[model samples]
Target: MADSTTPLLSRSNSEAEPETPRLAKQVPSLDDTIERCIGSFGWAQLLQAVLVSLAWVFDAQQTFISVFTDAEPTWHCSRPDDPSCNSSANLCLLPKDAWAWDKPSRTSVLSEWNLACAGPVIAGLPASSFFVGCLAGGLVLATLADSSLGRKNMLVLSCLMMSVTSTLTAFSPNIWVYAALRFVSGFGRATIGTCALVLSTEIVGKRWRGEVGVIGFLLFTFGFLSLPIMAYINRESSWRTLYLWTSVPAIFYCIIIHFAVRESPRWLLVKGRKDEAIETLRTITTRNQSSFRLSVSFSGISIVPETFDGNLYSAIKALVEKKWAFRRLMAVMTVGFGIGMVYYGMPLGVGNLAFNLYLSVTFNALSELPSSLLTFFLIGKLNRRSSLLVFTIISGICSIMCVVVGESRQVLQVAVELVSFFSACTAFSVLLIYTLELFPTCVRNSALSMVRQALVFGGVFSPVLVAAGRKDGFLSYGVFGLVIGCCGLFVVCLPETRGGTLCDTMDEQEYKEIIASNGGDDV
Candidate 1:
């Protein structure tokens, strides 16, 4: 083997590279090593992947819980016979005593904090603060999973922080305090989805790679679906009850992860922890497949960290310094920004639909069922770049159509909104999978986090848009359409990674690119 300066990659798992001694001939990739050691997906693999995917459920809970918690409860004439309160007039315009919220004032933050009439800025503050925290956390914590914390530790810490902050959020005395606490919660959970996706996929064989990502999507859908149910159950209770319900269970999940899951073997191998990687491989493999080894072939498997300086920012530096990685990053992020806008905005803006909030949200969540199932069955047949482009376009078209359909036909508007959200859901899932494939394992988590940050960055404005859209559909829905439509075009700039190999370092990726360009799988 050459010195550490030699840049090399293991051969494809399915075939050998044509000999080229100058390039250091064919060697088995860690992925190949993974298949040899853990040939089939076993019970241990299933449990760990399922456990990681489960985080998507809780993360979804946090993402959409505000839809119910901060909602402006329905108000009506204090007495049925009261003429002073007109159902036709704005609640803000009427005298305080003329009307009352249909539900108890404690049912939501809007009535409890008197934010219904306090204007959009104050009413939208908490949700906005949460997304801002997500953006900040994404930027700051993006590399930690790829660098020091490793996927398991990063996930546990993120879940713990998010849960504790959510628990404290239930006790906020005022709106300002509530908004700040929500910010902390958002910051804590920022890396939850990113770590889960990266860790889950890394632990499995390539045959299950795309499937694992979709499984997370399905769980995320389940999580989204659970919110409306829980909120409905606590409809008569304080908004605080919903927060407590979701947060407490998450704390228990964190403990289970600490005891049950192992760190990603690919991540361990990247950090040069050979023994631990071997142990992880052994644990996830079947009882019959006992001869797990990194092997002499793996002895030459050179993995490098993202950071050149060996500092906290090294991984990011690696991503940006490399022209190809930087280009891929910006393009995917643009698409994510659009998807995030429509994805988050539609749920929050359901209030503007002139339909029942609970039923409207239920319809929105149920849309995920078909979309996820389709993605799962067709994942192998789908082209990562094209799937993203088509879904984003479909989502944007339906979103704009929501405004054109108008509120006169309530069912139609709701249906169109559901379609838009469905496309966004599919695009969101495909984009996450695409991000996983585009970047290799070495800097995979950080790159995925940045893409999610782009998604969150788009979400930061959703509350404000939803707040304004309460009066006009265009501000939120219309803008959501235009942005996603334009951004989806960026997909053309990205390479199609439908059947690409998972390389360990940037150099390996460059080698893959050379092979791809030369019209051969190897040199």
Candidate 2:
């Protein structure tokens, strides 16, 4: 290889000077070489990616089940002896049976628990507590994935915990118990998506990262779409059935994950488990039918940590000490916070829209598919800055338009709301891909979790705003629009990452544009 001081000439100049030998190409780093050895596109890789993404479906199911289970069923005057039952005026004056539920009491939590007339303060408890759990869980357990636990172990544990807690929620005797159980379930839910994303992307070559990530998002949308159907099927049954259906499949999925999936090879190599990494790589190559030899390729490489200490404290220290990393983390998280507020707030706010809850939820869920597909397409073609800028601005404009259209024009309002949601969906997908590209494996899980936590942290305010009702657009649409638009402006600070390789260690990730300026030599 040429020395660092060598003056590199263009291909035409090099050819013209026949006596000058072309500088030997720089030997690829161990991580880059390993990625090439393991083929970029392969059947084995795709199968594993799809399997990991299946978890997102169940994660989505548990997330929005409350929309159906907590819904208020129809009610009417039922008691014949009550004076208001026969009269047409002043139902509150004769409170006896004047607002009796029309369906069986067990149909929904609001109906079964006699919370029909309960104010928003009490009614929104279950759903709101779940997100609170999400925030708490993500903050507390985020580092575990980056530390001793690794990606696979943390993912399996979280899936099992979420499933068990949610199942137990079905047997709750009171709203408090249900809310507590949901909180715990939310805690478990926090890591499932993050781990699935990290593990799936890590298992494959860099070219497939965006596609694999989008698979999880698509599965999530499918899961969201499933809720309304399940609720409709169990409409005559108890709300507990909804919990039962969603939780059971997740429990079974945990078993499959344990038996089928392997730890991330990139993580294994970086953690000094080269033997295990070689074995995993062999499996990948054999499945992909590649000709690369893991033993010969990594013979002289010393795969040691650059600055990371292989623990939570080290991960935090490394990220904070690096100027560029902390800035990237803060910038992306800021954008994530705004996107999260609208992303988490939208479905919950669907009831406030002047439309049927089922249809509105369905419309919003359906919007995710096309938006995700668009993201999948754009991720390959557009740079991170352009994609984030366009999608975030579009979402914000659509949200503002929703407020301008008003509720009186229900069709136009719904149309605009869907457009806002679709744009938000694309923005969120792009954000996830960008975050994955921005951070390295050492703190990838934690950094991604921080971005998610920012989103959930923003979400903590959403329920309160949503509880304010649909009297005006200020609470739901206007706030979502303004915050997302304002926060998205921070994206300009981030560098473009399209067509870049995934950085396995903090040292591998580029910072400060120094490399680009110095003829692409990594410092």
Best by TM-score: 1
- Model 2 misplacement above 4 A: 1-31, 79-94, 286-292, 510-513, 517-523
- The CA lDDT of each predicted structure is 0.85, 0.80
Q: What lDDT tens digits, residue by residue, belong to model 2 across residues 322-378?
A: 888899999999999889888888888888875787888899999999987887776
Stretches of candidate 1 off by over 4 Å are 1-28, 79-82, 287-297, 304-307
Question: Each candidate's TM vs. the true structure?
Answer: 0.93, 0.90
At residue 350, give the lDDT of candidate 1.
85
lDDT of 1 by residue, 48-98 (tens): 999988888889999888889998888888766766566546888887888
